[model samples]
Target: MSTKTVLITGTSSGIGLATAVAAAQSGWQVIATMRDTAKAGALLAAAEAAGVTVDVRTLDVTDPASVEACLAGLDRLDALVNNAGAGHLGTLERESVEDVRTVMEVNFFGVLHVTKAAMPLLRASKGRVLTVTSVGGVIGQPFNEAYCAAKFAVEGFMESLAPVAATAGVSVSVVEPGAVASEFVSNVGLADNALEQAGPYAPALSAYLDRTRGAFAHAQTPQDVAAQMVELLAAERPAFRVLTSDAARAFAGAKLKDLDGSAVQTLTGTWVA
Candidate 1:
């Protein structure tokens, strides 16, 4: 098989960075991009040490012009990984509309913008478009309403796009991974809107945030999640969704069961009250 050309977004850190390195090591020409190229020294060094030539560029997924220009840099792209995302921790009622919009712009619309810009190249190569979503995409979680909403939108958008892309000789797959030990948790952003005034559940919300911070104390490494992406990329007939790690698998399975059981409430009690 010919060497694949993969373009991965958010390569400055985390799973995106890991996937870029792994793909490059596997002989795929990598276009590793970060919001700010100046801060990508670690990624660049890691790729270099692995003997894989990674072309680093600046790409803020929320910018349309940037997306077009970045995609133009690549000649024949085979795969596009929509991995640029961030979390805004806060409950839905507490989060401001602007905060939710910002999350959507980066986590959801960012994927759309980058994917739209890269579709032509991917279509030409009969390549694949892989999105790094989360377990939240499949099931709702507390204190992550904004983030989960964005991911859920991604899952719906990609599911709708899959059939069309397949007919056009392109493939779309979503990788929903459980929490991984990346800077995402430590460096996560709180909903600025929620932080302002104390609401009805202010104490509970504060406690939730504190508990969440503690939970990140134990997260899987980015390498494990990246490996799943590589396998998905290499598969000939890849599924629509690839839930990475055991935690992700269990979450997805439970969500599926809940959805199916909802039709037969006599057998299964209420899930969402």
Candidate 2:
């Protein structure tokens, strides 16, 4: 039996890095990719520390040419993990349209770019596509309008494509993770000062931040989420949607169970007022 190969995007840090290492440890050949190869030292070091080897590749998911070039030499692809994403924080009214577009470009369109680019190989190998979406994709939260919108778009797109991809022998799944200890908040520009400058939204933002901090106090680790990804890739029949933790399942379940939207509104409403 030959070892399976998986190419994961955004392997410079966080979940992407963890997934790459975990997959390698699970006996898969890992092609850990990132937008900038210069930042790959951490992933390489981690892989070495884990007593595994991973091929580091440069891939910028938002750029179609880069996506193409990254996969050009790949002969076989057992899995493609679209973990590359960007974050945006602030109310829709305060966030610039450009910033919102940027988030969509990376979080939503980036997935499409990489998935589409890798689809031919995936189809050829009957591989799997696992994406790291968020609980926000299923349930919109306060002050996360733009970010949630992009995630929601990813969820919708993947769900609609899953059946069609299945006909070609490709399995697609979205992993929704709640708060995990990662650089996501920082990457989204949600530092303390940034939240403090919310102006009229400060109080609500503060409250939301407090709640988020409390959540992170017990947040799942990136490796925990990575374990789920690895399991999905190895499953004979993977589910369409997977939440990383009980909290994530419950958080996203609110929207799934409440068709009227009142439950979500009431829950998020507390953070705003």
Candidate 3:
């Protein structure tokens, strides 16, 4: 049997890097992509350390041309992992419209760009489309309004397309992860100054940050999330949604089980006042 090939975006670090390495070690021909090839040294070193090979390619998911050019070179693609995403942290009042649009561009529209570019190849190969959403996608979190909105949009988009994609022999799945130990915090532009700049929202921002810090204290590792991605890709019939850890499932389950918005409000309200 021939080895399967998988293309994953944002492989410069974190879950994308871990997934790329793990998939290669598991016998898949991995195409690990990132917006900037210069940052690929870490992924390359990790792959070498694991005694596996990954073809690191430059791909900015926010750019349709880049997505097309990157995938155009690939001869085989059995799986498309839309792991590229941006993070945003700030209340709507503090967040600029431009910042919100940036998040939407990368986290929401970026997925569409890559998925649309890969659909033809995926349909021909009977491949899978797996995306890394977040627990915030299931239930909106304080200070993550814009980010969560983008994730929620992606979740809805994928869920709606899953059945239609299935008819073409494509499988669609989403992996929702809670706080995973990664560079995501910094990537999302969250910094110490965020609280200082909250203005009238300072006290609430501080409380929310405290709660967020507590949650990340027991956060899952990138490998933990990557493991779930591997399983989703390998499963004969993967589920539409797979939460990375027990905490993630429990956290997201609150909203999943509660048809009314009360449960989510009660939970998120804890970080406010």
**lDDT, candidate 2, residue 269?**
91
- TM-score comparison, 1 vs 2, better candidate: 2
Q: Which tens-of-lDDT digit does each residue in 67-110 have in candidate 2?
A: 99989989999999999987777787776899788889999999
| lDDT (C-alpha) at residue 14 in model 2 | 93
Taking the tens digit of each residue's C-alpha lDDT, what string does model 1 give over 1-273? 778889999999899889999998888888998899998988988888888888898899999999988888778989999998997776666657998899999999999999999899988999999999998898776667788899999999999999999998999999998878897774556546654564776765666666655655666789988888888888899899888878678757877777555533432122212
In order of appearance, the predictions have TM-scores of 0.89, 0.97, 0.98
User: Whose TM-score is higher: candidate 1's or candidate 3's?
Assistant: 3
Candidate 1's C-alpha runs over 4 A off are: 191-198, 210-214, 260-273
Clashing pairs in 1: none
How far in Å is the alpha carbon of 219 misplaced in model 1?
1.6
Which 10 consecutive residues of model 3 have the lowest summed lDDT?
A: 186-195
Model 2 residue 165 lDDT?
98
* lDDT of candidate 2 at residue 48, scale 0 to 100: 95
RMSD of 2: 1.2
Pitting candidate 1 against candidate 2, the one with the higher lDDT is 2
Per-candidate clash tally: 0, 0, 0
Q: Residue-wise lDDT of candidate 3 within 1-273, one digit each (tens)?
A: 799999999999899999999999888999999999999999999999999999988999999899999999978899999999988888877868998999899999999999999999999899999999998889998888899999999999999999999999999999999999998876878876877899999999889888888988998999988887888889999999998889998998889889879988998998887
RMSD of 3: 0.9
